[model samples]
Target chain A: MTVDVGICSTDHVNAEVYAALLSELPDANLVGISGESRERVRKQANSVGAAAMSHQELMDAADGVVICSTNAAHKALVDLALRNDVAFLCEKPLATSLATAREIRDRCAESDVVAGMAMPIRYSRPMRRLKEQYEAGAVGELIAVSGVNRGRMPGGWFVDPEQAGGGAVADHTDHIVDIVRWITGEEIEEVYAETTTRFYDIPVEDVNLLSMTLSNGASFIMDGSWSTPQKNSFWGDADVELVGTEETLAADCFGYRYDHVSDTGHGRHTESIYWGADPNNALLRDFVAAIRGESTLAAAATVDDAVRTAAVIEAAYESVERGEPVDVDR
Target chain B: MRQIVAVGPETAVRAHVERYDRFDDAAIAGLVGVSEACADGIGAPRYESVSDALRETDADGVDVCGPGAVHGDALREALDAGVPARCDPPFALDGDAFDGLVSLASDGEGWLTAYSPHRFSRLYDRLRTDVDAGAIGSIGVARIKRTAPFDGAGWNSSYAGISAAADPVDALCAVLAHDADVLEWTFGAVERVFARARSGGRYDHVHAMFAFREGGRATIETTWSDEWTPEPRVDVEYSGNQGRLHFDEHDTLTALRNGGDHGQVAPPGDDCRGGALRAFLERIEGEERPPSAVDPEGPSRAVVAVRRSVAEGRPVTLTEEGSR
Candidate 1:
């Protein structure tokens, strides 16, 4: 069956991904796009031959919806999707709060629509290998995991905590949490976090360090910060390291093409292992495959996952207030 | 367990003592002699006459932080004493000083010297790593900005006083060498640099810009008097078609794609200084030399870049003649 995809909002990374998706998939017709203005929506949906329409009208015309709106507007967008019996792809940190996320998840669950989360990194080859290695005992027993997902501060709505939920934690927690769960074969049972703002003066904490205890006794640390000095230039890389009893495997997620670098540091030196595929394209292909029902949803981060991450975010603010650890309920 | 001996004035010794874990200063009389101490008033290391202390001590290296005038002499003496030596930057005051020391270091074991700590920062190393990993695609543009508030304390004593009294031209030349070496480390040899430097009567508040030969440019602005210290804010702004990369001192990386919010990037740890120092020390232990000073004619090339750029309001092409 031909799929009718309605892209909601053109102000996010997922909007570009979804727009690019329409270009890649000829079978997928982008019937319309909804935004604050007809002009804005028309501009974004122009290349896909889609028209600009009111939110309700666009929802009514589509078989599926892509909710790439700002985080605060996610619940309302999902509500629109549900009213029209449209399955939706909710760009993540799914809703600003767990209650909102659960509300959407429950509503989508009761509908005939298939729902998915925009967590493309999970479908990347390196993460797939990392998951495989964990199961094969390559990273034996998963002693610990660490991630530094930092970037320069960007413009607009992102700087507002009310709109984006949080800073580095809001933007970064998904990929790290997604990969950690995939690698450990367990869930983050508890999390203790601390957040600080040292570099930029954004209202939300730009630097946050989260320590999580997994259900399998493995502990992990995630340091997410937009602490790069504002020097009129480019952004940096996101890195992940999974340390086990026998060996350590690292993924230079942005820089090195999501390649794995292994080190025993005994007699042998580090070796770069290629995962083979541009991760961006890989993620898109996986999303398309899922949309076509050719594959089961390939373990993208759910609203549940984002809510859990937001729980860590909530605990981080608490820790910042109390100057001590606060337990994070998953 | 290793001990370090610093034989210079309190000011000279403080910087070294603060940086190295183990450091001690030898007596002025013990190093140069009684009379030489009377001349400089203990403000400088007895670069020419500090042989006795060098022969007596078993320290790994001696950082000759003496005045510029006597640095060549003190360095010559230290080299003869065979303790393996490094001195406070510039190698010495002029081409002659650097040449003499280069000759001595060429023949000696455990001979390495680095004048500035900024070059050894983790931020730079991480930038180098990203460049190596092809993070921002081809690295079309690489910009490094180092600016600071102007002040008198460090200016009168540390920077201006030393550079001016020695050889104003050579001092700027030496500082340029450090900048050139940094650029060379990331982008290959600087084929050309059209540069300009202005010292606003106040020695500390100097500004300079260098347009590199192959592609891109760099600007270094420093003032010892500004209220806010931008000392901790060295950033390498690299722009590529695919993505733009920012490597700043705070250990944060950021990338912007198709005009959305920047995707956050991970960075190396804060231990890049200690890491570089440890690497330098280990390289010495392994009997390898530190990366050669930018080039033999590096200072002269830098001098040409600054001279021509300052001379002509417009850009100047750095000729192959001055290059190392």
Candidate 2:
């Protein structure tokens, strides 16, 4: 059976990428698109040969939904999908805060609809190999883990506190935290963070660092900084290095590409060499397969995992405010 | 010309001799070790203790390369003898010990400093220059990662010869001494520290977060494990309002501004040990006061605070008054 998918809120940066990936899947049908702006939704829908339907009509017709709206609108869209008993692939940070994330997770857990968080790092080939090596004891018992998610400060609504919920700490913390949680299979017990608006004149912080201890007693550090300047070719890096008893492993989730120097508007701009599979496409493929009931949600982040990450981010923000390490509320 | 007595195990003393030989103006006058085993393979006159070296060497300065626990007594003896001294990191065990040594140096006709080669590194010099010039605006965050290969035989043997050989805390402090110096030099005084340390037998790894008193944050992650990188991995990045400066292990510094101006800055020079030795010799000649760059007390107190944070499992705050 074809799994009908609808794009809710076609205005996000990932909306087009998701639409294109869904259109390529054989068993997945891009049924419709809905957003706050009808004109943009129609244009986005027409680009992918899908109809621009009202929010409720799209929810009623699609078998599954992809929530690609701003951070503030995630909970309401997920609520609509849950009410319609349709599965969903909510964008990263299942919700803006812990309360909403937990509420959404609980509702999804009580309902029959499948809920997955869009954390593409779990699907990256290098990350998968690293996780396999950890499980196979290539690195003995995990002792410490550190990662970096240093992307350029994403402007637009991302810098808007009202729409984005927060800045670098809010947008970038969950990906590495979720990846570490996935690799170690341990929950974060405490978080200490420091954030500043040092990189850009944005309303929220563009540089954030988080130090955490996992339940297994391993220490973790994350540099979730939007410190990458535009002069660099690539957008940013998502790399993790793990130190274990027997050995250590370091993986750059996006390091499989080549580098090119282009003489563009700027004298010299470094660009990424994309030589491997796209992680976003891999994530969409898994979402389609799960929606088709052909696979389990083990590889994908569940709503519960999102709540856990949200809790950690919450604790990190609190630590930043209090100038001390704060315990993660389990 | 200046004559320097080296004190430590054979390996550490030999390393200091090699560094001194690189400088034309300084020579190793004598060697001091705890036993004949500690003096093995050394061609210089070997003394049984720091006091013996001080009495017999006729040296202008002393270089203390002993274990972390004995650094205080070594420095005290060198200062009391009216000879300037250069010691390795974890210069003292605690703040009180550090202050006492500083007081001795102040009262005596001698100067004291710590060996922090990174402060003399050309890359660090450029970054410091840029920060002082407000090229990166007000500093918000800085990160430094230093990872070295785990030499099981080297650390196991050296640590075993120390008096506090069984204390893991002392061993880890000695390993992280240089890191503490780098943190204090770049970020100013660290007001607070929270650290998590792990050990895999021979090598210990520490990941620490710092809250600088000057309203900024920094992190230092140092590991001496068997992670085989082609070379030593060191990366330092500073983030500020106007731009960012990055120094990779390749000995290259890149400054990227927010408005699209990007360029590479040439490093000042290498031979941090050579520069440090010259500074020590100059201090011995009364050509200058203790070079502020090599002040041993700042790093000593920082190391003490970091150790306290790790042992207590909480953030340890270092007030200026308390540290002094």
Candidate 3:
């Protein structure tokens, strides 16, 4: 049977990406799209060759719902998905705050619904290879890990604190945090962070750096900055470096590039050349497989994983406020 | 020409001598080590002790490169002989020892200097120049990482044991002192420090967080693990209000400006030890002053602060009273 999937909030950046990927899944069908604006949702739905339905209607009709709404809308949409007994893939962060993320996680655990967070970096081929080598002791016992996720300041609701939850720390931290946990199989135990809003006039921060200690005696540093300028040739960078007892490994999550310099209006551009499978399609395939009971959730970000990331991020924010390292509530 | 008595037959000492020999103005008059066999490895005249080398040779200065514990005694001997002295980091065991050396150097006519080869690297120099030039604006955060292959022989020393005459943590701190000096040079005086350290078998690791007096922050992570390749890995990054600057062991300097302007600068030459030795000789000639290239006092205090933070299980403030 086809796994019917509906996307909420067509305005989200990943909504169309998910819609396109889901439509390509052999056993998955994009049933409908819903958002706060009917006209916008209808336009996105028509463009993706799906039906535009109300949020309640979409929840009732789909086997799995993809929550692509703004940060503030995740709790309600997740609640609706849980109420309808549907498997859901919520965007990263799981929720706006630690309490809300935990509530969603706990509620999902208590139910039979399959839930995952949309963490595409974990599914990327380079990151997958790095994780495999690290787990196989190719780099020896893990000693430390560092990551950089520098991207252009995402405008729109992302800059609004109420809609996005926090700034660069909230928007960019969870992905790398989840990746570190997934690679090392360790949870973050404490965090010391510093944040600043230096680049933009927005209320939220654009630069954040977090120093974290893992449960397994490994230290981590993450640079989550929206400092990429508009004039850059590429979107930004997502890279990770892992140091171990015998060797060191570094993976550029988006480093496979093919530069194109044309005299047309677009000028120079550096296109990221993904070698094999598309990460989004891989995530969708796994989600479909999990919903069909064909396989258990493995590499995909699970509910607990989402909550752990939220906890680290929450502790990071607290560290920023306290001006010291704060213990993470696991 | 300035004739120098080189102390120790360690690889670091030999490397420094080899680099310094490239310069025509400095000459190694003798090689001193605890054992004559060790000193005989070098081409220069072999001596069993620093005093023997200084007493028998017309040396103008001494380069102390023995184990960290001997640094204080070597410097005292050099200062007593009234010769300029240069040593690597972890120059003294504690602040009091460092202060005593500082007083000796002040009273004597010979200059006292410490070698921090990383600071002399062309890439590191460029980073300092860029930051001072306001290329990246005011620094908000700085991070430095150093990882090297573990040498089991170093762990055999009682100093490396958990219960030694001195704190075993100092063994790791000695390696990290240069990094701490770089942090101080790039940012400013660290006002506070919190750190965590672990040791296993022949390896040790330390992760420290520093809050600077000028409102910036820094994290320094150093490790001597068996897993790293033969070539050591070093990385320094400075994130500022207007941009970011990064330098790595690959001799690459990457600058990311706020408006999306990215530039990679690679300076020529990898002769960091040569640069440091040249600086030392320059200081000996009265062309420079004490604390040239690397300040022994700053890194000494940083090590103490890190050790205290680890021992007290709290951040150590760097104020006048708290540091004491």
Best by TM-score: 2
Best by lDDT: 2
Query: What's the lDDT of the predicted structure labeled candidate 3?
Result: 0.74
Instruction: Flag regions of model 2 displaced more than 4 Å.
Output: A264-266, B34-43, B66-70, B133-135, B149-172, B226-231, B250-270, B291-296
Write candidate 1's Cα lDDT for B1-324 as tens digits: 333445544444443433344212222223232246443553433433456555555555555543333356655666666555544344544334555666676676435454333345545667678777876554334444433321222211123123322433444444444545566666665554433333322232223444444444344433222223333234456554334566553444233334542332322112322333344344435554455521233433454455454444233444554322
TM-score of chain B of each: 0.61, 0.79, 0.80
Q: How far is A154's C-alpha from truth in model 1 (Å)? A: 2.6
Candidate 2 chain B, poorest ten consecutive residues by summed lDDT = B152-161
Deviation (Å) of B117 in candidate 2: 0.7
In order, candidate lDDTs are: 0.54, 0.75, 0.74
Error of 1 at B317 (Å): 55
Per-prediction TM-score to the true structure, in the order listed: 0.50, 0.89, 0.82
- Residue B5, model 2: lDDT of 84
Candidate 1 segments exceeding 4 Å error? A228-236, A256-291, B1-324
Going through the candidates in the order shown, the clash numbers are 32, 3, 3
List DockQ, one per candidate, in order.
Answer: 0.02, 0.38, 0.18
Better of 1 and 3 by lDDT: 3
State the displacement of the C-alpha of residue B175, model 2, in Å, after optimal TM-score superposition: 4.3
Residue pairs of candidate 2 with colliding backbone atoms: A233-A270, A233-A271, A258-A273
